[model samples]
Target: MATEPAPISFARGAPSLDIIDTEGLRAAADRAFTTDPAGTFAYGTSVGYKPLRAWIAERHGVSENQVLVTNGSMQADAFLFETLVSAGDTVVVERPSYDRTLLSLKGRQADLRALELEEDGVNVRAFADLLAGGTDVRLAHLIPNFQNPAGYSLSGDKRRALVALAREYDVTIFEDDPYVELRFSGESQPTMLSLSTSGEVVYASSFSKTVCPGIRVGYLVGDEDLIAKIAKLATGTYISPNMVAQSIVNEFVRGGSFETSIATVKTALAERAARLADGLRAQIPDARFVDPEGGYFLWVEFPEGTDGDALFDAAAARGLAIVKGSDFLLDGAKNSIRIAYSGVTPDEIDEGVTRLAQAYASL
Candidate 1:
């Protein structure tokens, strides 16, 4: 009997345990319990832990009324979708967006308009053209910074242009940017929420990437009324979010360990991204990809005729696990793939790319 070798996964978009600040989290948890055991353990308001919500509000320069903390960003996203997206409502999304996002929208039966994602981000010109065509789009979801699956950041010009289009079309923009803080290089851009004077942009972010995944703290910032509506929905869904986790996060942030944790992950991800890019180029010369400045993912496109399904199987057989590109799109991308470089070490990246190259050769 043949036993499969240990798999090197490029499928998970999570920080590896080595990069998680467990010690800091432990200390924060201790502090949270000691400082406010009653509040941390008790059932709280749907608006979430008060101090943490206030912190998030202050950080984003929004009032507490405009912020709604949730179990995670996904919950916040769901609440927004439920509040805004009726069945068959027209919604915009990036073509190769996070698979989970695509699935969620599909589950809601949304009429999704997917725009092609480029190195600089979603094609705003195309989006503008769509808006001009008079499709009453209800929502435009954007992963503006270090976009999931694509690993491309939206350009400043495009961000402004998109905001303008959203304002013109009277559409709400959902800025689902969980990876905003993970940038290891490049200057940060102004958030679309910050750019929109019309209050058309709703921003969502998570601490899962910067802190640790299990912390499960995430929030949404937007129009006060919209946030209030979502908070009501959240109350119906779950009594309130995990106060224990939020309390710990609040402690972690106040104690300044959160920034330290981010610095560590950023440095690690930078090296890992570089190694993956270099290894892919060296090992699989035919593989086409944009070297990402930051974030967990790198999108790769093989020559047009390559069968993505076959390549996926081949990679699995070679002890490498990768996500098929078709998973992210509504139609075809049979030769494309998404590689998450965040979960593996540099040595693992070298080995994984070599195996991936072999898989490609076999195909």
Candidate 2:
């Protein structure tokens, strides 16, 4: 058998943290060892490190009591699901959504309902109709800003309406907003959590995008009582997130380098996104895609009769890798694919798109 070549991947979503300030980490570690060596090494509260919690709260314009740090946003979702979802319970999610979220709910045996996504956001009218038609929705998981696999942001009006619908239906809304700060274009939009009136939104975000994914720090902001319950669940799970990582992030934030770091990452991501988009448009004119205002992905739809899975295989055969859109959907859509531009450089973007064009040609 002929040996296969290593695949060039456009499937990663996290930032390339090679350029992050290593000196900051050293300083933070020095502070941790000098001031509270015992605390740094010992297990701490599950609610997350105090200073990190305070920093997150201040950033989001919430109180520390409203925040609960988890191992990552994925853990935060699991904790919330464990606390809120029962077997046979119904939850609404975008049609093409995060695969991990779908897996998490499926593992818990929740009835997953799909809502179609429009260019401006989730179809609010369809969602409202579902609620009106008596969909027993217990919760709705939404990615309001630069949605995964779709690369579309919910408009402010739609966001407010979605929040209102959740309030009217008396259902909790999980605003999974890990990509809100990664915007490379367009004006900022209001978060679903900010528009929600009934405190029905559980807002989650992470440092995995703007900072190093290895830090594994993410947080949930919601009703204090609900947050407290999730914190308890987290306490039982990992006891708490890594205290050393939390302290490093907290010190970075306090030293006023957090904003600078974010700016640096955003600049690089914007350049990469532009490179990917332009390369795709030039190389594959038949491919249709929405230019994402933020986030690392561009969601592309091939011409009808195109098989994304076949394209995936073809691309992989040519030493390139891309994710088929069906993987992100509860009910598979066979025509689309998600291309992530965060990890690859401009040359890689060009080469990857060129390979993808060849794949499409083969199909």
Candidate 2 structure lDDT: 0.85
Q: Where does the lowest 10-residue lDDT sum fall in candidate 1?
A: 1-10
Clash count, one per candidate: 0, 1
- State TM-scores per candidate: 0.98, 0.95
Estimate candidate 1's RMSD in Å. 1.0
Report each candidate's C-alpha RMSD, comma-separated, in the order given: 1.0, 1.9
Q: Report lDDT per candidate.
A: 0.92, 0.85
lDDT per residue for candidate 1 within 1-363, as digits (tens), equals: 289778999999999999998999999999999999998999988999999999999988889999998998988888999999999999999988888889999999999999999899899989999989989999999999988888999999999999999898899999998998889998899999999997999999999998888888899999999988888888888989999999999999889998999999999999999999999989899989888888999999999999999999999988999999999998987999999999999999999999899999998
Give the Cα error of residue 336 in candidate 1, in Å: 0.7
The TM-score between candidate 2 and the true structure equals: 0.95
lDDT per residue as tens, model 2, 1-363: 288655678987766655466666677668766777666677889998887898888877888999998777898898999999999999999979988999999999999989998889898898899899998999999998889878899898998898888888998999999988888689898888878766889999988876668888888999999988888888777787888887777777787667777787788878888888898889899889887788888899988888888999989888898889999998757999998888887778888888888888888
Q: Candidate 2: how large is its RMSD?
A: 1.9
